[model samples]
Target: MKLNKHTVATRYAKAYYNLAEEHDCIKEAFDNMMDIRQIFGENPGLGLVLSDARLTLAQKRPIVDNLIKNFPELMQNFVLMIFDYDRMGDMELIVDEFEKLYDHKNRTILAKVTTAVPLTEAQKTRLADVFVKKLDGKKVIFDEVVDPEILGGVIIEAEHQIFDGSIRLNLETLKKQIAK
Candidate 1:
């Protein structure tokens, strides 16, 4: 059977998360994963090189080792294992899944907030406070976006739900009501 990337990533992330939990180094592990994600993101070709069939493990090992030399021993071993399993191409997905697990465990929610203009620090704080109450007291982290097309008002997306209060949406709703 062929396992999809998400399934593979989830499995690896869960295993790593469990290991981190067992060793009581969840925060450190999370930080290391973030660093790895950043490295892959900044050097997009690195994953491609690591996943290339032409490059033998011996050739890849030095690269992987250099990249992770400063990381904790457990993280270094975990990354080596990923390379061993030939899943280096899916490293980003694994990191994403690990982040989701970490956030859930920490009771943190990442909310994407869109506004016609950038929010001030005070506004951000207020929005986060409101979302915390709405999201069952989970700590809210904003991924703020500004889009003038919204015309006015805010649109918040969190936990698979969208709270759209944008003027554009409101105008559309009003137009529909008038047509009705």
Candidate 2:
């Protein structure tokens, strides 16, 4: 049976969320995941270390131990589970999905804006305000990214929604209209 990445990610993320809920450590899980992602991102060598399945658990034990310092018990359990499943490469993806699940449970909706250039403070505030109004009862967490691919204007993405209004998008729309 082939496993789809999103389904696999959801399964692993949900399992961790369950453990976190039992221990009242959902926030801890989120923070620990963020920390782990940063560690993996900053030290690409960790991937090589984790991928060596030939290394005995005893040999790999120190790596896991030293890497787990101050992590919550739930995260420690998650780490152990990953090691058991040989899914350490998917840790970052798992964390991201876990965060989405966690936020869903908490009624937190994240909104991301990508534009060709940095948004002015007033523009960011107004954009967030508009999304907040549209997503009433859910917290609108805003993230504005600068993407040259956008050419101009903004691409707004919220939980369950995407509003692409960039110049690049408009050009594509115009091209489609002409073709039709």
Candidate 3:
């Protein structure tokens, strides 16, 4: 099968992840990836500029060099390698994949919770408790989103599964039942 963006990103990220693990610099690599990801994410045009075929390596070298100046040697090499391969445009996706791999290796899972209003510390703790049980004791990181459109209750999204208990969904279901 042909390789898509996600596929290519996963492949590169896995390689980088293994390298980081071998070097015992997973944390450092993660930090470097985050910094690079943020830089590209904020200045999207820079990736395009660096990835442009019209620009010779000589033209791009200084830019890449300045970008990775503060990075560890291994990370500096990784960043430069991406530029060398004309993969700068894919940096963000690779960073995202790397983050997932890192999180999995660290036994942490990300949860997105949507509620009608902001949750209190106690509510967050309770929700975390629920997910901790469901995730087999893996540590949970919560990303909370407050949406009044949900009406009430909460929706929990983790590992591609959604547990939606919002009043809006309940109302829709009830309306369908009544119509039938």
All candidates: TM-score: 0.94, 0.78, 0.89
Q: Tens-digit lDDT track for model 3 on 33-70?
A: 99988888788698889898998989989999999898
> How high a TM-score does candidate 3 get?
0.89
Please give the distance, in angstroms, between residue 141's alpha carbon in candidate 1 and its true position after superposition. Answer: 1.7
Over 43-101, each residue of candidate 1 has an lDDT whose tens digit, in order, gives 98888899999989899989998998999899999999999899999999999999999
Residue 58 Cα positional deviation in candidate 3, in Å, after optimal superposition: 0.5
Q: Which of candidates 2 and 3 reaches a greater lDDT?
A: 3
Off by over 4 Å in 2: 145-153, 164-180
Question: Clash pairs of candidate 1?
Answer: none
- Which 10 consecutive residues of model 2 have the lowest summed lDDT? 131-140
Worst 10 residues of 1 by lDDT: 129-138
Off by over 4 Å in 1: none
Query: What TM-score does candidate 1 reach?
Result: 0.94
Model 2 agreement with the true structure over 1-180: per-residue lDDT tens digits: 989768888899998889888888888788888899898998886756776877777887778878886786668878988877777767778889988898888877787889999988898778777777777735767787889988998898886688999999999999999999
**Candidate 2 pairs with clashing backbones:** none
- Among all candidates shown, the one with the greatest lDDT: 1
Off by over 4 Å in 3: 171-180
- After superposition on all C-alphas, the RMSD of every candidate to the true structure, in Å, is 1.4, 3.4, 2.0
